[model samples]
Target chain A: MAGQPHYREAHPLVFVMTHWVNLICMIMLAFSGFYIHFPFFPGFMGVARGMHFFAMYVIIINLTFRIVAAFTVKTATDLGSREVDTDIKNWLPQEKNKHQFFETVKYYLFLRKEGVISAKYGSLQKMAYLATIPLTYLQAYTGFAIYGPTMKGGFFAAGTTLVGGPMNMRIIHYFIMWVFIVFTMIHAYLANIYNFNPSKIIFAWKETDH
Target chain B: MAQEAHGAIYDLLAVRGVSRRDFLKYCSYIAATLGLSEAAAPQIAAALEKGAKLKPALWLNGGSCTGCTESMAQVDTPDVATIVLELLSFNYFETIMAAAGKQAEDNIAETIKEGNFILVYEGSVMTGQDGNTLIVGNKEDGSPKKGTEILAEAATAAQAVISVGACAVDGGWVAAYPNPAGAMGVQAFLDKEGIATPVVNIPCCPMNPEWVVAMVVQWLLVADDDPAVFLEKTALLTKTYKDGITGADVTLNYPEYVVGSTIHDNCPRRGHFENGEFVSEFGSAEEAMGYCLYKVGCKGPQTFTQCPVTRWNRSVSWCVNSGAPCIGCGGLNWVDNNAPFFKRLSSMQMGGSLGNVQPGSVAAVVGGVAAAALVAHGLGMKAAGRIGDGPPMETAKKYDRKRMAKGGDK
Candidate 1:
């Protein structure tokens, strides 16, 4: 297994670029957003706000593009497999992923000695990934609702009123940022826990043999 | 009767050194502020002139600090005396009225009997301790008449109600969090009592006196002393909240012109904000230069008011101009929203012992706990011998295996 052929079918170049965009934009947004929330330093308020809005737009557009690319791009159907399928098939749940949900959880908890055979993404992975789409859109909605100029619009005003006011809406936005931060931390640690091969492939597009 | 009243007012204005021209100019300014056309200025003047009797008004107090009354005294144009003496009859103003004690209490009763007066309410409607928290006067039976009871009776008989300042608008500081005395805004209390009279809310810690004056003029000239017409002409905005006790929706009306735009948009420092200049600390050079205070916790971006345009203290200066950030005093539940006024965000009240918590601290604790959990899980994984490439793979679930064993893999 160690000297087996390295496969490029797992991630195409276009998907790699999108992944980089997601990573960069996420970092920029988190940093600028934190700065905007409470300026830890002086004189960068305007720049921080500009970066936050800019990165927000970029990430939203990149996410939409990536979703579209899923239907067109081809990737490995299973971990360490050379056999390829449309990326969406791997991203969404397949027949092979059924009935192994608890087994995967048990394995992660060290209750099970053996791993659970599943698709490219485990059931838990798929759920977490899917949850992000709506969460991202919601963050944007809350953001616009808090912005001064846009908040006056009837659409944002209705939301602001429903949540009670601007302060509550702001708290919702702050909590969602923590969600993203924790997601990224777990995602990074788990992706590199076993080895650096996954990071190499995603970041450098360099294939690794299992 | 109308001509004599008109002459009397003119004579009073002349005696006070406010010429008819200066008075008309002031009227036009008020008309503009109320979102009325210039033509309405003459209508306002005519209304004041032709009125046979001065409109009776009750300036009542509840749980107040009298800051709003102080602000009212600072009205520069026609002055407080002109408003009380000439425009409206000050039958029951506790702060400035000549009457006191029983005589002051009698003025309220007499005004209520007349039944056409406007009720100007200041401070929160205290409903704590069975309304015993605030006692304004005594009833005929010698028992104390709660401030709430007096307000209820006066509000019922009034032609219109004006809720002045943050306390009367939404309970101000007293209603912040853990509101022990059960303080609530006038509108909420009125809704609880099932009173449907329209209330014009002028919000701020202490309301802008000019705004109050403008609203009063609007009531007189544009609405022709009609409450329904006043609500109609003012372009009022409504916010609905579900009543906690009744489970019914209570809709409150606010003037759109005052609460429509953010202070940030109209701020003079907005240019500095766009240019990325900011005052990081008080007494800094940037503050001297009058840079944007966004970094120093200016709630201007979220606060809706014309403070920058209208200014304060007779339009000489305002909060931001005085090197202080807006605490968002115009917002609903302002004390809760704008507390820790020097910070970017309001702290959350965790109740009882924990008190207020910051968002950043909450995030840090969550992240720290997750990191610790991951570290513990890693050790467990190593002990289970499933680290390198993970544990052995299971092809199917336990249920799938049982189904195949029972009959067939259909």
Candidate 2:
């Protein structure tokens, strides 16, 4: 575990900024998103809507940037090591993650007391993180499909008709919001369960060791 | 507190005795209630000025909850009490009248004999229990008359019939579910009886009293005081169902404007729906924050009514705005379509093992099958001992069960 990312190189400066952008966009999305859902007051309709649409585009852009960086950036090659390798391989697995899927689930369920030993991230974590990419895009798709001017677009309209009606499409859009919410809770808890070291590294862009 | 509308005209007749100021004020109010601009005030004033005595009216009740009458009572402007006294001779209103028994039935008979009166029908026409679901009786006659018979007799001599509320227009809740009393609307019942009078439908649960008053004023004061104009405005959306016994076209048609657009078109939360923010749980932060109720099952997207704008309680508030989602009470077959309101769609009346299942659940289950297949593929890789290796597969063993028993030779 020498040269372990317990100190530096765990997160680069660009990755840190993108993470901040993601967090800010999520907060804005959840807040203004609710305001636009039901206007509690008579006015503020225009402001809430602008904030919602603005934050939505920003989050989308940030997500795309995050994906590209996943391929290009150099980060830790192992869970605790500062050695840099291709980011995708560390995010996923080396050759070791293939047989570890059930073992990871078992570790969480307490079926296997100790955590599954692996190269970097566990299989379940990899799957969950990968799943979020498509989910975010799906939320974006459903959102645009229900929007008025944008809804008239061919692709969004295709989503509309494929779902029978706008109401049905709207429901899909609503439920996906729930997915993000639940995902955020688990993601935040899992990342913070160990220490603020990961948080300081990604958010503050400062190295911490304990 | 105000005077009976056109009470002056009745007062002038000497026999009826009503104040003129009360009469004109009621006319002014009716003019306003009907959404006629201020210009119509003088014309309304002139109509009531000339219209004296009364237009004899037959108010019949069928299989009903009397909610229409209750709704009418709730009319704050020009209150229904004034409209009845000022414009029409309410000879018989069963639920409100002090008259009862043989005398009551006789009064209805006399009203019909007048021949030029207006007919206001509430509730649904009942045909079940051998036509005994609703029976009109007089103490002296000591025998009940079928409701269908009464409607037939009333419609025959009537100049025009007004179908008020969902019940009179389409049998309402009395016709919901099994519809045991064989409930049918007034128009259908009279159609079977062969009555030729025009019928105008005013919809909603109990209907807006203003709409009914509007139709009445149009017939009594405007449309050149012609009865046919009543049918012409509301004829587009209604379908006439034939009444069997009387062989009459008793069904009336309704206006499309009030029901043309879905509630979502005018809903305030509709924007939230488009934005994809939703209240997944009742009383949650999302709900408190006023997010879209679509996820908590708002039928506004499919329901047709001007409720979002027109609202209820003198424009105080409506269902969606009040945090309760729409149940689509205004749509066709509303109970059947809008029930299980907390969910996206209707549930089957299935029992035990087959019980209610949502479309979402069905889709998830079908997706689960695909997930299971993927899991099985993973298992197939494991059994072939391809774990630390990639899934370029070879079906290594199970086919050689006999060779396992002869393993010593191998």
Candidate 3:
């Protein structure tokens, strides 16, 4: 802790805002989505549906904004360094990240005693983060297929038919939510495992230097 | 001659105690149901009355319980008996026809040889045990002519095939999971056999007879007995589905108005649904209040059928009106897609003894397992002393190690 350095350059102000939006939207969407699936209590369906749809749209927009910001925004390319580059460079596979995927897995599993030296994000982290984009869009697709208004469109209807029926489409949507839940659980644990420096910088925009 | 024939129709209607006005009114009703203009009513009347020779027809039955025939019989306007007996020359009708045994068998043969007859098929096409599941008549060798054999012969020669009821459309409940009988819809069978006759599908548990009547009249008046014209002139929605049995693509035609919207979209209790007033249980006070059946497993939201507009039993009362949740019999593969009928979602048939399982239960189990695994992994991380400040960091990258092995820093 005495020798370590952390700075605001790791996660700039705008990226922190988008991260908060993502966190808040995901929580609201998951809870509201569960309620819409089965209204355990009365009189909340209307509100639950409204909240679910609102969060869905917000999350999609926030994700798109985050992706676009990656190209324009600049951030620290390496930990403990103030040198900056467009954020998209850090997201791309860097020379330092080569062959680090299995090493990171080994370190997490306790099979290796030391963590892997890598770029801004380890290989596993980058892949998981990138996968969320398509998975979120797929969730939207499945949602629209079961929805009454948009379901009749040729594009959605064809997807519904391809999945066999509306019921099957609903089941797939339910399963994808579980995938997100699992991903979030692992993400939160890993991000905070090595103390809360990542969270402090991402959430509170604070810097820690010895 | 045409005038004499037209006069004979009114005289026949008078004999049946149906006034000329009532007859014309019935034609107008059919015209409206077919989405035709008011002027088309008189044209329909002319086409129906100028029946010097009635269009030949054969009403065939396959793997069925005769429910559709019973439903058709209950039609009060013009009555199905009059339509079958007088309007169309139904040379062979297994139900409500006097001809039977050899005489009835001969009628089918004669119609096939004659050609140009409309084939109204009821029930699933049985191809089980290599087509021995349903036997219609004996072959010339005194063995047995399968229902599949009879349907193939009749469908091949017919100008158009009208597949009446959900059973004839997509095998109904007969083709449900673990379908031991190997039943399938007529169109799928025809596709497998390479029969080129265009089929008009009227799907429901027993089907609304009005749709059948509208199709028949449309065929006579608008299509001029041409199958191609029938498809072109009618407002149809065509969808190509893979045959469940043979895995072959089969295109089916449904009347757009019939399968156009979900039953819930036109349900009388839709106000209750939007208002969140639901009938939670059968025989409850809420049920008496006629609330929406969505909570009680009404498949109306997913089922596409105009049941609310065209009520069953001659527009008396449909499934929801009678306080029963819709079982979604109008949809394709309805039983498998909407079974465990009282629940919101369908149960998945988990083959063998596993039986039907709810989708929610499976999701709950998977989520539970995932949570438990995450907790155990957390405990493992704590035991490994990797929870605080994490593991030691590698000073050099894995690639740097190779560079160092090749002698010193890169």
Candidate 4:
């Protein structure tokens, strides 16, 4: 088997930085969020809360920037190719990804020996990636609904009341955090399963030639 | 005549050994609790002066433990006796009415017929077994009248209804998970039956006596014996519940001042929280120093109440002050929300045979399973020759290739 080519057009330098910010913020948010949820250790409630809020804000801002950059940045439309298109086109489903959805699933399940020809992201990948946007916002909304000071606001109060009360809101927030954690786990494992090339390009921005 | 009536109230207070000055001080305290200014104290006093035409009240018990009644007895300043004897004609209070059996049932019936009266309902509205779970008294033919039947009749005739305690607000402990008696809140049951009588909910495991008194005083001074006016004067927050029976939105009203702020925000040990000083263990040096109970499963942050300020049992001490974490008894579905009582988060109901499980344990099991599955999937990928530079990539789908061959173009 020949080594597949990697290109800088797949992930721009700006997106690399944003991805780094997202990764770091998610890690911190999860850690501090867990701590605040159940102060497993002593003497860190204030610090944990401060870190959780700080990370939450940073991740939200980073996510917004990434969404904006998706329209502006250019990235490769296909794996192992330098041919490019607007990043949003690749991030979202395109003509090339139409019928290859089940084929990609089949390939991963070991039913198919060859990889399916598709866009940079498979249909499942695109769907999962798209879900994070709303999931993140929902987490933040539920967070605000449970927070003591912000909870009094009519908007947050409506959400709290809709879900019955703050307890349910808190539970929703906790469950969503787990969703992120599991997503991260599967994402990291699958991204690195074949090789660390994707990681290298995304994290280190190192391009490789076949 | 008004002056003579006013003198009679003072005379009644004198007979009860409560000095005029003490009574005035109590009025001021109540005004303050109602979020009213000191000027409202005189208005409250004036309302009490006209207490000769005592507001007819019936303190009814449903599926209760009589904790709210016990809490009422703990009212310090004006004293429970003064409230019952002079300020309000409590026609049917089971705990202290000194009348029972047929006499007590007759009192409730007579009070309902009078039309202008306040109904102070305590405990969960037992709706289980067609409301047979709680039989309060005997009917006309010596048959039993369900507690719900009695409440519906009384609530319909009452001028205003006060749902005192967590039970009356949302069925408290009895309505916790796997609720045996099918207990529900008074407002919810009323909404289901299409009863339009407005409920004022004062939610705590045992109703706070100070809050009850403040609401009663607010009714007298501000509402001026009018239920609609009472709703207008006090800033009431309404919560909409979809009626289970009708599937229509049922709006329940609660006082804003009571549920506006969290116990954490008003907590006395908040300074210690900011300082990151916490009591990890009960009865430790940190506990003695009055550190925050956040680390010890204090539900104060999520619980909305003024318990920290109001202080239970005549301002002596509260739960956190007594070194017990807040169980969030002031919240809706409180027992289910804050139980395990000593943990930061409540155990989620997994339903069926699995029953209740902790949130942390669930998260851990999920994360672990996901990780394990990923590892197995990774190994499968490797076995299928999909690792390294990855599997062989096909140029096009078979259908796409067939289409291209047929066109013989591009």
Compare the candidates by DockQ and give the number of the best one.
Answer: 4
Clashing pairs in model 3?
none
* lDDT at position B94, candidate 4: 88
TM-score of each: 0.91, 0.54, 0.92, 0.94
The residue-by-residue lDDT of candidate 3 on A75-151, one tens digit each, is: 99887778899999888889878888888787767678767887777788889999999999999999998888888
DockQ score of the complex predicted as candidate 2: 0.04
Reported per model, the fraction of native interface contacts reproduced equals 0.58, 0.01, 0.48, 0.70
Candidate 4 per-residue lDDT over residues B347-384, each given as its tens digit: 88888998888888888899899888988998888787
User: lDDT for every model?
Assistant: 0.80, 0.66, 0.84, 0.83
Candidate 4 ranges with C-alpha deviation above 4 Å: B1-6, B75-85, B242-249, B283-285, B398-410
What DockQ would you assign to candidate 4?
0.60
Which of the predicted structures, 1 or 3, would earn the higher lDDT when compared with the native? 3
lDDT of 3 by residue, B101-188 (tens): 9989999999999898999999999998999999988977899999999999999999999999999998999998877889999999
Model 2, range B1-410, lDDT digits (tens) per residue? Answer: 22335455554533334345554555565665555666676676666544544667878888888887887666545432354445677788988877887678889988887678888999888888878888878434567788877888888888888888777876767776667888777777666666777787777776766566656666756654567655554324543433333334443466554555678889998777656667778978889989878766688866656677666664578788899988866654456545688876554444579776554465456556645655574555355543432223212222233466678354
Give candidate 3's error at residue A153 in angstroms.
2.2
lDDT of 4 at B58: 94
lDDT of 1 by residue, B165-209 (tens): 988887778777667777888888998898887898988989888
**TM-score leaderboard ranking:** 4, 3, 1, 2
Q: Would you give the TM-score of chain B in model 1?
A: 0.90
Flag clash pairs in model 4: none
